[model samples]
Target: MMRIALIGTGNLAIHLVHAFETCNATQLVQWVGRSNTPPKQARDTPYFTQYQNNMDTDVCIVAVADDAIPAVAKELQHIDALVAHSAGAVSIGELEPINRRGVFYPLQSFKKNAPLDWKSTPICIEANHGDDVILLEKLASQLSGSVHQITESQRLQLHTAAVFTNNFCNHLLGIGQSITTKAALPFSLLHPIIRDTFEQSFASQAVALQTGPAKRNDIRTQQKHLSVLSEADAELYRILSKSIFNTHNT
Candidate 1:
């Protein structure tokens, strides 16, 4: 089994560690972190205090923040191993040339306590060499059925699209929940509608599945809903509605 060292213990790292542990082709040996690290109460994995001028493994995965990736790669410069980062926006080459590098990005948002279906999570990868890419693909394929080799630019575009589809969509849900709660309505009432929205989206094109007052240009109800929001939110709602209408009408 290939030995793997995972850096960081955040939400993504937590999910990744579990996936790696379950992969039959790999064995997670070291969990590295920054200096003055907190107590790792979450997992019982072995820990390494530092990454510089020391310990090596078959693969070193830096699943830390985007800004921290470069520093982590620099720290691992002296070590001979396949070094990679789990970042959507950052390029595989962001890590310096001294070490073999690649991207082992899992295209899914992770929560610490929630269980992730490894098979459903898409893994996007890029590598400095053919062998490195093959190695990462082999490892990711064992954990996830969906694995794609994409260019750095394509990965960045994917990340940007995720912000709109996942982040912005969640923000809209939060707003809907707040509006319902303030009006003395249970947010649970919207669950079915929300679930249906996603279900319909998957069954058809998202634009084709779009509905509500904006789709029909029901100006009266649209104005009423906008009136309930603050000036900024009202303007935002108006702009978004118009954009959605235009998109569907095109």
Candidate 2:
């Protein structure tokens, strides 16, 4: 069995703690966290508030915040194990102080206590050495069915796309929710269409599946939406609608 040490108690790290516990091929040897108390998922495992110079494990997976990665990397530089991080945008080079450095970035948003079937999620892996890449692939494959060896530039591009796809989309949806709540309508009313619209994108190119007043160039309906929205939301709506219109006509 592969011995693993996990660092962080954040959203992704919580899910990974569960994943490591459930995976039969790996054992979670230690969990490192900022707090003195370990998360409940760290049950029966050794826990430390700090990274040791040397770890008794095959791999140490750092799932800390992006800005703290280099500092954490410095702490684990002397460890005799593969030191991998679970950040999408952070490059494998951030962990370069260690002999065995790699990335184990899972390309999915994580929420604490939220149920997610890792088997269907994609994990982007990268390493300085061929053998370390293979090791990360092995570890990632155990948690996720899909794993790709992504280059740094490719990872940065993917992260940028993900921001638009997930973060920006959710913020826009939040604006919709606020609008609905103010109008005494349930936000759940948009649930089905929202789910269907996104799911439909998987069938083909998302641009080809575009619909709505913007796509139809229905200026009247676009103006109606804008008039009902607050200044900030209206501005955002106009920008997005104009983007959609440009996408279709161009």
Candidate 3:
């Protein structure tokens, strides 16, 4: 089994600990973190609060925040292993002078200790050396069936798209929830339509699945909604309705 050192105790790190532990091809050799007390999952694993100059491992995964990655990498410069970070937005060059720089980005939003189908999650791998590419791919393939060797620019682009799809979508949903709250209606009222809309989008073209007063080009309904909404919300509603109408009609 390949020895792996996991550094960080954040959301992604927590999910990764579960993933690396369940997989047979790799072992959690070291669990490095900033806290003196390791998380419950890391309690049984070989854990460390500080970086060792001569750590022994096949792969050292730095799954910390993007900003903290550089400082963490600098500390592990002396370690003789393939140092990788679990960041989609950050580039592999952040792990400078480490000799074996690698990007092990798992493209998904992680919730600590939540159930996740690791096999389906996309693992984007990158490396400074060609041989390291094969090694990283092999490791990632074992944990996840969907593994892709993407360029740094491609990974960044994927991350940006992910933000629009995941983060922005959630924000829009929150806005919907707030609108329901104002009218003294439960958010659950929208749940069925939300579920159906998501399923329909995946089943076929989302553009074709679009259904609303705007998509149907009902000017009366659109105007009524705009009049009821706050000034800021009215502007947003107008912009979106116009886009939807144009998308379906033209």
Candidate order by TM-score, decreasing, is: 2, 1, 3
lDDT by residue (tens digit), candidate 2, 94-198: 886889998988999999978998999999999888999999999999998899998989999999999999999999899989999999999999999999999
Score candidate 3 by lDDT. Answer: 0.88
Query: What's model 1's overall lDDT?
Result: 0.84
> For model 2, which pairs clash?
none
TM-score top scorer: 2
- TM-score of candidate 2 relative to the true fold: 0.94
Pick by TM-score: 1 or 2, better one:
2
Give TM-scores for every candidate, taking all chains together and pairing residue i with residue i.
Answer: 0.91, 0.94, 0.89
Clashing pairs in 1: none
Q: What is the C-alpha lDDT of each candidate?
A: 0.84, 0.90, 0.88
Model 2: residues >4 Å from true position, as ranges? 53-55
